[model samples]
Target: MNKLTKSVLALAATTLSFGVFADVEREFSETYNFSSNGTVRVENINGNIKLEGWDRDQIQLEYTASADDKDDLERIEVEIDASSSHFSVDVEFKKKSSWFGGWNGSSGEVEFRLKVPHEVVLKMIDSVNGNVAISDVYGDIKAETVNGKVKIENAGSDVSVDTVNGDVKIVMQQFKGDQRIKSESVNGDIEVYLPENEGFRLDAETLNGDLSNDFGIEVEEGKYVGADMEGRYKSGNARLLFDTVNGDIEVRKD
Candidate 1:
């Protein structure tokens, strides 16, 4: 082949190789030493975060911070520190140094998935438009979201989930320690499913919907949109509190 033809072939091959090996995004991972009484705090603003509990004693974190321009993501950092007897994880945003500083007109997102020890407490705070899921944890959980949904499954301790405009669902076996469930939404419903013998200081109310329960408790006769019942189950232990502002409240025993 001639020199120009060979040069064209070489350029095409290099382009193909670059397409095959180049990464449009990057992943960041870090691990920190943890204690049994430590707490894992995950905070994010605009993406989904999933936390799974493991059987080890370490904090594992993985996240992908990406944007149209890589410089915008430079401001995103995950900070892990030992605070008192607990470990805290936070998503830190680097502030702009000057008037025209720090990704003022950039668009990107990051997704974080971590696996921490099951014995560590969890504190999750999502500011806006982020969903959170946690599973297989044996520690106390406190989760709050302003415009997102929160879901917990197979939890082994007390959990409190609150959302302003999203539905909350919790499915667990039991709360060996004292537990409390408080879910409130101005435009969403609250549903609680418990074992046949679960009990607590029961108080459920609704403002614009009906209330129905199947645990065989005595509700007072009143002029209300929901039932005003107060009694303890045979094996009541956890303190169950359920509320809904403009939706129905249901208690189903399995």
Candidate 2:
């Protein structure tokens, strides 16, 4: 065979190898020193984001990337911006920033697991195609995602969450001096659980679903062409407002 024919055969073999190993996976983990009131923010364009607060003074982060194309795993950049009391994380790829939720199944995916200080703050965590979950945290938190679920449990302070095509669930341990909580979604449910004795101003609405109040409060219907409810829980001063387009909304006690 000629040299040109041999080169073509070699190219075919290389292509076949890449196809066979398309599902490449990569893992990364790191730890950084952090303190109270510190912030950890993430701008992820794919997969899930999970964060938990601990008592330690350091922050731990672990991420995994999987893709059908090997280069898709290799092209992801986890950029960190840190300061004395805050840290920022940005995940980058070749696609547009709005591609965070509009990618097809053939694209690569990334999942993040973070351990932050129990008293640290969490800024807006933006994502498109993955779920966002946080538990045992004690500060202000703002998270938004599209086409995924958002769950915040055992919150120690205020929280604001927004999502599209997913559910929003939050459990508050205590209220902090009129702290405001807001959650909104386009195609999912919004569930809030609060303490028994805390006073809360409840404002909730759903377009295509019902509002259930297990807190002994009444929800009036036909408020705005759908289910809507507003009331004062007890004698407290905190506020909570939530709305959804195609799912149920519930407020209950802990």
Candidate 3:
């Protein structure tokens, strides 16, 4: 073939490749409608998930997926289940990308950013690497990650979190609306800062870490090995439960 002819064919191939890449593999948006209450479940493989509470009645979800090959990116899927009082947002990636695409890094990674009403329950889980962040939410919050930090603030309800190797931090203004916090890490630490004169029960224990409490409890057995700490404060109402294996557990008044 002539030089000009060969160049024209190459240009056509490049354009086609780009066109394929630009095409929408899979894209859709869903909104859940409910009246009484709502719950959201989110799971991520190797990305960050952030949730924020809003005033609207609808639950909104958005995602961004990445893959090693263009074709693999098209196979990402999101499932939405809208119930009477609960909803779930699930992300699924193609399993056999290696056999079909023959790419080296066809694994999928998606990051989720969600905004729901303040009265909705939030449950999130991540496999490889993800960080959980919730702000201005009053409902129940439960999140777990393998290798990412967990941070929550301005919450008015109960909270539960578990991580493998990441620090967990919770900041609350007035924890009087039935608080139950259980956070643990084999390598990281747990820190909680709450208002002084809070009224609630405190059950804290640690096997390999030091336990510190500002409730004026005398030290015993080199740790606060107590079943419950109640009537020590007179303001805030909470039910705090903290435990860690290889990290420090701290509970202090603000």
Candidate 4:
């Protein structure tokens, strides 16, 4: 064989080898009968989780799992438990055993997209390494993450959000009931937007950050290197509390 031909064959083999071990993905989807006042919970480890409220009286769940190796993809498991009043989705990773009798690290990613009734309550939407987003929901919401952002838009009831390493943003269309709304972050900003005519008591503070408001409430400087805002906006029974350790807090009128 000629040298050029041998070099071409070598290059082709390398390319084929790469193609054999590329990332693999799998998709899963399901629909369930759910009530408008049901509760939904989702937990993820390494990808985004997005939930949107719809007019339908059911819940639709779709997720995609991807990994660099097919074996790793197989090790990732998704668990879903559902009923008429509640639904929960969880992602669990099965440990792989190494030749040395120890656990080998398996890596995979899962992105979940869910749609449910507009009046359902989001009890817990937690993620360890991905973002959590919800929109157009009319019930109470509670979401937290260890290393991702938490964002909610068009929320019609009370909300509570917490994050360790990302921002928290909540935009409410209407503040329902006298329930308290709270948001906290350890290393990212917190921003909340409410209707201009809504009445709420605001108590926002940050340890090493600044506070800004559009409701004409005064922001007081902390003793050290922080700021806080405490007062009532239109003097209502609703209460809002926001705090952060290393980021800014902004309260704006929608």
Candidate 5:
């Protein structure tokens, strides 16, 4: 063979080596007719979940599932059930045994991005090993995660968030009625932002961490190794609660 032929073969070999390590990915996109007052639910594992609110009367979902092995990528499945009033998306993983007979670990990661009606309620957004984020939403929201952060912005209604090993942050654009807000973390910080002149009853506590706020509520040091604050602002009709085991808590004015 000529020198040029040898160089071409070498380049092809290099490209094939790189391809061997590249991850396999699958993409999905779907749209459903939905109502403004509908409910949305999502269940995922091992990847991030992001949601945004829009003015359109529909739900748009886009997701990507990736893995190192093509077989593992095939094991990841997205199950979606939708209607005019309710929408649900669940990420399911099929189990397989390893060479030694033990069950293999997670199939892959599934990242989700969704756009829903502005006034739809997020009844549940649960994840086992990924972050959950929401923005520009005006209905009640509930989210929980085992090992990832949870964040919300431009919220206009009640909120409930919890995480086992990640931080939590919430920004309230406006409070609706006497809505209740609660957040808790096992090993991460918690921060909440609200209007400067909003009225609410605040109850915040932290174990093995400090407490700070922009609401002027007195942070009382615990007897041993933590701090807490409980007070009311203005009308104090709305209730807010925050707790953490091994992190700080902050209530900020927007």
Candidate 6:
């Protein structure tokens, strides 16, 4: 082939290769109509998930598909189920990428963010390898992460958060009725912030770390040789339990 023809073929090959190996990034946003007492449930494999409460009577969600290879990004599905009294948004894979598309170290990740009505009755967020955060939410919050942090802030209801390999932090803006908080972590710290005037009893325990607080509650050594603290504040109507295996437990007055 002539030199000009050789150059043209090389250019075409390069373009084709680029197209085959390009990274993929895409965003999806959706809004679904729903009445009060909505419930959102999420399960994320490897990305952050955030939840925020809003005043509107709808569930709004946005998610991003990111992968080092274009085809790897196509395996994720944002599943949504909206009913008059219940709603759910889930991150699911069309097929498990571990078997089909995980060859040659292709990286894939997805992040989900949602906003729902403040009167939603129940909310559940779960992530395997990424952080989970919720803010300004009402009702009951149940959040968990296996390898990342769980942070719930400015919440106005009961909360239960658990993490195996990361920290857990909860900041309660106020107490609604008889609020209950139960948080646990296996390998990281657990911190809870409570309203100053709220009456509650704390049952904080740690197996390998210190149990601490700024509320001046005395730390009582467990009968089995661990750190356990139990005390009441004022009326002690509310209840809290912070448990950790290899990290500290701290209770702070907000």
lDDT of 5 by residue, 14-38 (tens): 2211135587677666677788999
Superposing every Cα of model 5 onto the true structure, what RMSD results? 10.5
Clashes of 3: 4
Candidate 6: tens digits of C-alpha lDDT, residues 1-254: 11111111112222212235576666666677767576767778889998889999888877776766546555545555666667666665544435556634336677888888887765678999999989988878899899999999887778889899999988887777778889989999998887787788888888889888877789988777688899987785678888899999988888
Q: For model 6, what is the C-alpha lDDT against the true structure?
A: 0.76
Candidate 3 TM-score to native: 0.74
lDDT of 6 at 64: 72
Question: Candidates 1 and 6: which is better by lDDT?
Answer: 6
Error of 6 at 28 (Å): 0.4
Local accuracy by lDDT, each model: 0.64, 0.79, 0.65, 0.85, 0.84, 0.76
Write out the backbone clash pairs for model 2. Answer: 199-236
- Number of clashing pairs per prediction, in order: 1, 1, 4, 0, 0, 0
Task: Output the better candidate (2/3) by TM-score.
Answer: 2
Of the two candidates 4 and 5, the one with more favorable lDDT, higher being better, is 4
What candidate 5 gets wrong by more than 4 Å, as runs, is 1-20
Give RMSD to native, each candidate: 11.1, 10.1, 10.6, 11.1, 10.5, 10.7
User: Model 1: per-residue lDDT, tens digit, 198-231?
Assistant: 5666777666766777877665544755455566
Candidate 3: segments with Cα more than 4 A from true spot: 1-32, 97-105, 123-128, 218-231, 235-237
Supply the TM-score for candidate 2.
0.84
User: Candidates' TM-scores?
Assistant: 0.75, 0.84, 0.74, 0.89, 0.89, 0.84
In candidate 6, how many Å is residue 114 off? Answer: 0.7
Candidate 4's C-alpha runs over 4 A off are: 1-21
Q: Provide the lowest-lDDT 10-residue window in model 6.
A: 1-10
Model 2: lowest-lDDT 10 consecutive positions: 1-10
Q: Candidate 2 lDDT (Cα, whole model)?
A: 0.79
Clashing pairs in 6: none
Model number with the top lDDT = 4
